[model samples]
Target: MRRAMTDQLSGRLVEGGHRLDVRVYFEDTDFSGVVYHARYLHFLERGRTDFLRLHGIGHRALMDGAFGEPMAFAVRRMEIEFLRPARIDDVLQVETRTALLGGARVVLDQRILRDGEVLVEAAVKVAVISPDGRPRRMPPAVAERLGAPAS
Candidate 1:
């Protein structure tokens, strides 16, 4: 309870159905002076990772399992829109929403914002897989915690 309250106040952790903010760095930009298109993908990935972390899902644990098999998630598809441009040192925020949760897939809606302006938007699809790269069902406990599958 106390930890929850603190995280809420500090903005390091978010509540259920929440948004997390992240800043953009020079390394995220390209020689063209604007954020590279691929950089947006990185931002979205971080947003999803943070969302899961805040919800107590340790990605490392999933990857480095006790059975010596590295569980992983792979991006299967993405639809992105570049609404605006972002530059070096821009303090951008990646807003993430859990759009869908499935037995073997997760979909995320993410937006990169700068001072209330949308720079980019994306819908990303990810599939969970075993070390051998075979699709796997998401753990029941994790699924229950993330709420029902998107219908």
Candidate 2:
């Protein structure tokens, strides 16, 4: 059973390009002892952080860099589907992949899974913005890292 479980997850991880492991805590649970719906968004955020890190773009560095432009990313929209319940103490893996990229926005496909079962899936759209809060074209370096063509 354990071997089958590992194989299933491994296959999914490969399909997603990368995987981030996160263990749900008490704070993430609700009155029913299952992970609160909002907490799934937090899990997805963590996954995005790890995904950027893997591509060598840390949030801190982006916020404080030679660009000195004080860049920030805003979630313009998100479509989420909760298929299963996750409980406290459950170790979930978040898979993130870039599905689409536009001049000023990116579409990310993220999923939370446990033991081969998908618990949640989300389509997150984020826009790159300047410190003044105006949407801007993604920096070439960041775009290239994300597999987006450099402008």
Candidate 3:
């Protein structure tokens, strides 16, 4: 069912990425009702998380060492741009795609859009780490799965 079940709650894996629809609630906005800039990070994070989940590389399994050694993913860097503001009640789509994959990190490009108009864009770098927070090489199976197509 590749890219065919966007109506699912967790969103769906698209042809080249993942798509999630998020509602702009009052709590996601500020005093003026515009979405808070920081909140966009959460939306983007969820997109990435779900993307990995759909790719069969869930964080819970990785942290539980289902890949053979316990590890976690952490944001190493993020470059974001706010193109426009979203107000309450708006339904925004967050799109996420893998831009790069390395031995110990993955770079993702994300965007938030309303009615097909891009409102925000971001480039995020995520690193694999051990339970002690030390940097570590991404497990081979994990990297392979990330580079491979979704089932």
Which candidate number has the best TM-score? 3
Count clashing pairs, candidate 3: 0
C-alpha RMSD of candidate 1:
4.0
lDDT of 2: 0.81
User: Which portions of model 1 miss their true places by more than 4 Å?
Assistant: 1-18, 66-70, 148-150
TM-score between candidate 2 and the true structure: 0.83
Candidate with top lDDT is: 3
TM-score of 1: 0.80
Give the local distance difference test score of model 1.
0.75
User: What TM-score does each of the candidates earn?
Assistant: 0.80, 0.83, 0.91
What digit string (tens of lDDT, one per residue) describes model 2 on residues 47-107? 8876876676777887785344668778999999999999989999899888888878898
lDDT of 3 by residue, 1-151 (tens): 6444533767888878889999999999999999999999999988988888888888889989999899999999999999999999999999998888887888888999999999999999999999999999988888877773332
- Candidates ranked by lDDT: 3, 2, 1
The predicted structure with the larger lDDT, 1 or 3, is 3
lDDT of each: 0.75, 0.81, 0.89
Off by over 4 Å in 2: 1-16, 66-69, 148-151
Model 2 residue 113 lDDT score:
98
The candidate, 2 or 3, that scores higher on lDDT is 3
Estimate the Cα RMSD of every predicted model relative to the unseen true structure: 4.0, 6.7, 4.0
lDDT of 3: 0.89
